[model samples]
Target: MENYMMSGEGEKNSSDVVYLCDEVFDFSTVSSAFFILIFILSVTGNVLLLFVLAIYEDLKNITNLFILNLACSDLVFTVTLPFWAAYYLHHWIFGDFTCKFMTAAYFVGLYSSVILLTAMTVDRFITVVLHNWWSSPVRRRRYAMAACAAAWVISIAASVSDAIKVEVETSWNNLSTCEAPSDGPDIKLGYYLQVSLLFFLPFVIIVFCYSAILKTVLQATNRKRYRTVVVVLCIVAAFFICWGPYNVLLFVMSMYDPRGCNEIERLYIAHSICRILAFFHCCMNPVLYLLSQKLRTHLLQLLHCKCVRIKCKERGTATTVIQNVAFIAQNSAVTLDPHSK
Candidate 1:
């Protein structure tokens, strides 16, 4: 009995001694710089998208409503990144509240993003495949708003779980780390489920939906086929390329943690790289959405109108030249009028 007790104590001591990687990269430099860049780009892009969707009366479609929510989610998520960047630099300097909030924001953004993407795909599918029943303007607007609300509720619940489970730990080196307890079985299970449901399942759905959409588009003979297919493919492919590795790496890390794994350093490095790729997703959506030909043309027309007004401030002569150029272009066969006649 004494021998067994002694062995148990020894095992406990071994487990209590936290092991950290020897060659952990000084990620502060790169992480800070990279996240700052992402924050600027994501905030600027998503906010501009939101503004465009809001102010542009012509863009007041159900699809734009969903996109507005998506941009809002991305904006909220990007706002939390600076905290993470600060953590990476100063080692989780924020208190427990911030830790919870920031972590929750991250997961919320993730869950919301996937849910919205899935919702968007389903919406498109219904509109395209069941146009008779699903394409009504009133019904589409109602459904899209409902879907957006449901996504927010689901994402909030998902993020709340993380807020509940996460705890801040201080290392011997005086660095505070936000993490779950080392032997937290419930937390581990929750983590696994969160990743699986929020990322893996949604990814499968997206792939399946996009594949079917592609097939359907190919079978049809619409003049808009090339543009529509390219846009959809770009969106789907960007999501897969940016987020896929992060999800895979997260699963691998979760698996390896419960079971003793070798080459910890390599896994850690891979995780860091995956995280960087994941961050790119926040900014990529705006570019994909805005770069669509329709949106670009609208933006250009707005800009040109604004430029014409601003140019009027320069001088009357320049204004007359501009008007004459416009008139001659409108009546291409006629020469520019020298006088009012």
Candidate 2:
């Protein structure tokens, strides 16, 4: 799609970019299916995760705090997805405030998740790889919270500026859009910051952590060490699988566009596909994190209680059903080691 003009300005430029690219492919079919599926999975997974955390575990632990923060970040992205889905089919009609808020929230989700995941890896590094120097419990929790706060502040500051600059654009046939216009320096800076903070630095930390963990676990006698390595690897893999290609592709595009129109078209199409793939990371968090053995035990107990309740109902034992529900709720409580990473 071609476009141009300031908000409510006079005639727009006959040719304009949609989504910072030369052309906007009609990706409604591709977008609609993926967005809806992601929305459902992300919502269900994150919500279940939040519920499990609130009911079964205390958030006072530093590790749980990071997990909670990550889930909230995923939820931030998930909540705004419907609007984006609508925007894909019909351009952004949600007005300026919503355009800014939703777009910024999307960045918050992306940036914050990367940051938190990085933070989690760092914590694990200290706790596992350098256990001898691990600090006091109180100090560890305080420092973890401080790290989380720093990440939030940085991610928001980096992302919110460009998001706020987003204004509605009227494209062909008067369809409105929420793209931020490209200013060469600003876009280059945004892309640089995004690739650096949101992907590169975090990726390095995660890899270092797992590498260190691998060396230690291989030497250690702890049975749980291998399990920790496996889970951490799954997480690191998920992060890269979802965000890696998109980050690399965008960074390259930002650096230089030697390609002609056809190449631009193909690159943007790949970008669109990467975006759809990246969004699925939000949903994967629950499966990867909350499905830990301890949480799984609680889930199985919950299911067992439901079965008992059903049998009690068949037996016409109203009191037993109530008792079963109470029993299940009590069983949900789990004590997680705060520094277990």
Candidate 3:
């Protein structure tokens, strides 16, 4: 809040120096384009996945509950991307109120995703590693739903806490920017908290879960279940790969303050890129990618069946017409006879 200045940076006293405005702002267009594309793909992909999950009766299992919630989280995140693209293209026009709301929702999406993924991992751990003893305590779907509900609640709380720190600068080139508060300590603390809970902790837990699962698989030489195990493990690994760089960069920024204008600019560019990469993760979940394959197969089968049905209907109609015409002709010939034959 204290950092933004358009024409009066030089007038400020030396102790209050903060925030460097971009001289060119040239990256905004490119960033906007990339973000728009991400938004489109995320929305399109997640919506179809959600539809498939909703319709497919057999997929309504505990594991799929988490996957469904993940898709929901992605949709929520995708909704915010367009706003952000608009913000980058033209400064925040929606005012501070919408800014706070958008920022909160944006973080809610992210935090919920991480929380859900962790929940999924822990559920898998229990199912695979401790299946006989662990799951007896609770019903799987009910428990998974409860966990997802708790995640949503926790995510809302976290987002609101972070949203309080958002501030609006109104006159940045006659536009407003809703950004994190410019308090150094607060920014550092936010970064630390985010990196720890959202990335590091989740990453560690997933790794631990998978390690145990892998050990379990190694001991029992059932090659039949190995493929499913491997696929789930790869999904978890991809989650980390997608989000790791962004969190690492965020940590680095928290630890190292940008000193000079050039350093600041470079860091700014890097941060922008990392933010895009991080946001793009909402669209690239492992579960969704796996589900996409199944969905594609199902859709193709449905289309093929539909085509067959259409052909069958066409043939049936033609046969019915021919039969009716033959009956009419026979009746006409019968009627044309002077005497009954």
Provide the overall lDDT of each model, using Cα atoms, as 2-decimal numbers: 0.71, 0.74, 0.72
Each prediction's TM-score versus the true structure: 0.82, 0.80, 0.81
Instruction: Report clash pairs, candidate 1.
Output: none
Can you write out model 3's per-residue Cα lDDT over 123-238, one digit (the tens) per residue? 88887798785555447777888999999999999889767877777763686778875446766666677678788998989989989988887888776655556656665676
Regions of model 3 farther than 4 Å from truth: 1-25, 135-138, 226-228, 259-261, 286-288, 291-293, 301-309, 315-341
Candidate that beats the other on TM-score, 1 or 3, i.e. the better one: 1
The residue-level lDDT of candidate 2 at 116 comes to 82
Give one digit per residue, the lDDT tens place, for model 2 in 172-254.
78888888765568666766765786789788878888889778878888757456557656876897899788777766655
Across residues 1-341, which tens digit of lDDT does each residue of candidate 1 receive? 00001010112223335344334444456766888899999998887777667666354476677678888888878988898778767777888888888878887887898898888877776665555776468878888888999999999998887777677778677778665453457766766777788888887887777677777777878837446446555666787798899777766655553212234445555666777888888999889986577777656565577787776766777788999999879776454555435
Between candidates 2 and 3, the one scoring higher on lDDT is 2
What would you estimate as the lDDT of candidate 1? 0.71
Order the numbered candidates by TM-score, best leading.
1, 3, 2
Error of 3 at 24 (Å): 6.3
The 10 consecutive residues of candidate 2 with the worst lDDT sum are 1-10
The residue pairs that clash in candidate 3, if any, are none
